[model samples]
Target: MPERPRIRLVPLAASLAVFALVLRAVHALPDTATGLSAEMTAGAKASGIKNVVTAVLLDFRGYDTLLEIAVLMLATIAVLSLRTDPDALSRRISGVAGPVLGALTRAYVPIMIVVAGHLVWIGSSGPGGAFQGGAVLGAAGILLALSGFARPRWSSGAPMRWVLAVGLLTFIAVALLPLALGGTLLQYPDESRKSLVLLVEILLTLSIGASLTSLFLASASDTSEGERR
Candidate 1:
């Protein structure tokens, strides 16, 4: 029989200590377990946003959300940088689209656009927001790319780059604007809070959609059949 490996006392002790700390933290939880719901609800009301999630995300925790979008921008840039094919953005999925896919895409893309717009607009008072709307918009773009139904001529140009950047740029601009007026960063002036948030959401939808589509185009280069003429 093989000799059994000896368990290290030091590691065992460390593991026990970590487990003890976790248990202690768990035990410290309040019996009622009310959580921060009350505070968050108050904050949402103070912010004048009917959607608590949106208020928390775009208002109370703006910096974190800002960093999230910035991360997405960075990720898109990284994906584009790593692409081996120079003409990836100009390429589309190869092979002809079947009539069914072509027809569905033609009918669905417009509806998706309208749905995305509704999501963005209703976010302030409902369940949807920029991220949700952007995701849908991005999905529509992906559907178009996959079906090879339509590829915009402007997709590979500087305008597309601008679309990819407008979200973060506008977020940063809005965050800094408060500083010039003697307030903290991202402190929206009461009068224009809703307006600023709406603007940011709209730009974010565009940028997020463009970024996701660009990432797909860049990353799919190797797998695609051939560049379209």
Candidate 2:
């Protein structure tokens, strides 16, 4: 075995060096009060949502959220791209589920859709939003897939692309809409801001849900196809 070279840290010298740098950095701090609370409050009020968290997510930092949705869509695309044909994972269930389970799943799905939409609507006045609602909707999508309810919308490339990128496209369109109307990007008229915010959230909820469900189903189906191969 070869002997490795010993590193020379010289503990006392390193400690002094670190301490000096920390002190210098601390001394460089500026004396200014943060306005985070004020900013968040104003943003929420402007957006007309009682849920400050939702306002922040879908309004204050909407661009980031939009990008996040795009990223998710991209990931789903990457996964789906692995296969050449749409039937890559057309198989929904590994085996036939009993009628009881099928009936139960059917009953459960509508309720899930209502709950998911409710969450999106209530987001303006509560701690919920498209992301939360979308999560629920995505769960419903998984259930549908398991029960052999999904019909691979991906069979048609154009519509499938729209489904995956809807959220991002909607956000961008909304932001640019204001510009077309002589307002800044994402800037809504005072009278319609609340309505507009709600509309965006609803759109986002659907898009996110669809995108997430696509990702899950693609992975599941792709894996099944691979196993079969």
Candidate whose TM-score is highest: 1
Q: What are the root-mean-square deviations of the candidates from the true structure over C-alphas?
A: 5.6, 6.2
- Report lDDT per candidate: 0.86, 0.76
Candidate 1 residue lDDT tens string, 26-74: 9998877877788989877777788988988888899999999999999
- How much is the lDDT of residue 159 in candidate 1? 88
Off by over 4 Å in 2: 1-35, 84-88, 92-95, 153-158, 221-229
Off by over 4 Å in 1: 1-28, 86-92, 152-155, 223-229
Q: Report how far off residue 61 is in candidate 2 (Å).
A: 1.8
Clashing pairs in 2: none
